[model samples]
Target: MITVVGTGTGAPLPPDAEAAVAGAALVVGARRHLAAVRLPEGAERIVLGPLAPALDAIARYFDKADGTEETDGQQETYEEKETDGQRGGRVVVLASGDPGFFGIVRALAERFGSRRLDVRPGVSSVATAFARVGLPWDDAVVVSAHGRDLRTAVHVCRSRPKVAVLTGPGSGPAELGAALAHRSGARVLVVASALGDPAHERVERVTPGEAAARDWGTAVSVVLCLDESRVLAPVRTVAGPAAGPDRWALDEAEFAHRDSMISKFEVRALALARLGPRLGDLVWDVGAGSGSVAVECARFGAAVTAIEKTPDGCDRIRANAAAHGVEVRVVHGAAPTVLSDLEDPDAVFIGGGGRELPAIVTVCARRARRAVVVAMAALDRVPAVRDALDAAGFACDGVLLQSSRLAPLPGNVTRLAATNPVFLLWGVRPPARTEGVPQ
Candidate 1:
């Protein structure tokens, strides 16, 4: 039996939870987590500083007890596959704050069954940080940069005026500062580090560069209040796209690209249909030659991620984002590989992928909330891309886009100039079935 307790750092554990830990035989947690608690004198204490090593020790303990084969780094899988209905042993895992809120409790729960484990949660560090600043957390977005993606932290700050990022050594205030530095506006960055410890420190209203330079103590959470000198308008209390852009889809010449490289407005209209871009949604403009789709999505208040391969193309996307006066995060690199560490997107629109289109389509279709891929050449690739999306559980569909524009002839008479044919392939994720299932 493993009992997980949240010490909540500076805050003391609740009466009932403290009693639970005092009665436990084996306790597992980080050094800080361990220090926060008052353990019984003879309980076998396991310091969980390095995750792999600590999990190995747990695996060994369980192996010896059950007379089963020993596994090291695969403790969670081993426990799940081997454990019968019997109680293994008395163990306690401690974390900071409410373990359920993006805390160590997830790791523990993934390793051990929730039924066999007892969780005694304390006040979440995120809650404590917000409380210290006298801010309500109901609408706050809580993200952890602890052994996970920092892009979420960066993107949240980019799109939202207020965000709370749980920071770690590499993903601390410095990293956030660096991401924020891309924008020129001043931000009121509050770093709350070591909240409950003796060396607790809180740095308020520091500039991005200064926050980057400071040596923030352990277990830091950053509250960034964007001072919107750069933002033309304040975020409206009501969520969703601001009603300003007169049209949903604009003309083909709306964006600057290399001689007809932009996705045609007609095609973009259908792509948007598949994309379903809306407020609070995150969209990706993969192979974003001119960032046209991404810019449009951002216009509708959907957070956009524009991925481009060429250096010149990346520069164009950035310029386009700034020109449109919307926050569209631009990532520079080739598709599929460059897409490695990005946040899961609500929708993805591929515009320039060639043979790599299928693989790119496959990856995005599997991960994104919806996807659309467009290609001008390589007619053979369409079947493969459609097949990939279908295999990845998307409801696959496509359309061929052909457009003609009237131009003045030698006599000043208008003549139709045919544009190159382009194929638009799209898909959407089927919503979960709630029709017959009891809640």
Candidate 2:
């Protein structure tokens, strides 16, 4: 049997794990984990560097002992010969914290099978980090930057109030801090390094600017990024991020806009519905006039980027976002040009694209993973935007919104005031079809 063991942050191994390690004929783990455990004298030790070779060795060892015929001769050279006294060899795979949580057991299970793995989970780094900080983690979002892009982790830090980032070599506290240095809101980055190893263990709290300036060597286990202002949330039945905002489609008066340039509340509500912004989603607001849409999207827990050409518009967007207590990245540049540099988004909202509506729609629809919502005052640009979405393989749908709000008259009475009409165009990417799934 292949036993997957989790070594908790610098703690003694359990009796069962100790027994397993002592009896293991082949022990495989990282250099640190290998050095920590006492392996059987006769067992072959494999220090994990490039995992493919070690996995191949493990498969060969297990297959040979199980009396399985080797069809491929690849593993024959590395196969360990059994001694006269030994019967069947036992394999032990050591992992940090929980092997099942973004750990090596997944690779092992995929190569072998779940039935073969006997997982012994220990405390996760996220749990340990939160414990070190004296904070409750039930409301926190946990993301791993190990062998993956750091952009998602960065975005989570921007949107979520509390997040635990599992750091890798290149994507540690410094990288994360650098990304958030220019972002709005006050954040406290708790860098927890070398957990469980007292000599190497250190937990330091730093600002985004401070974190960006320093080079924290390769010992960092995890970084807890938190908006210190909103760390403790109100008691709730649900955990993690709250279930979106209570009310969306906020009034136009709520935002700071120039000459009523913002999209009306009626139009914004429909656009938000189509955009479907949520946690872990990145949204782009191209030609953000007053950033009303961007602010609203951010309120829904989506990381938003508002791109506007005018300096005043950019400032207004930032102001509006700050006023609403949400984070919206204001990019002071024109679309189609600045759009290239930004990360690909899950959704895109086009507020004012001018002559470049088609080009902006093309770029957004091309990069957007889910949907694109566009708000336009001119009816002439509707066909072109719809055509652009269609060309990019998006199923297009649109509606013209015209609303009348109640206004106080000179007398002690109210009158219906009609707002300018806007066409709300949205395109949803069709879900990928599975081979055996029914239509």
Per-residue CA lDDT of candidate 2, range 74-179, in tens?
A: 4342345554335456789999998888899889999999998888888888888999989998888888998788988988899988999999988999999998
Off by over 4 Å in 2: 71-89, 250-261, 308-324, 331-344, 353-371, 384-397, 402-420, 427-439
How much lDDT does each candidate structure score? 0.73, 0.88
Q: What TM-score would you give candidate 2 relative to the actual structure?
A: 0.80
lDDT of 1 by residue, 110-188 (tens): 7766676788888887777767776655555566677776766665566655567877768888778876675433466
TM-score of each: 0.59, 0.80
- Strongest candidate by TM-score: 2
lDDT of 1: 0.73
Q: TM-score of model 1 relative to the true fold? A: 0.59
List, in order, the clash count of every candidate structure. 2, 2
Model 2 has an lDDT value of 0.88
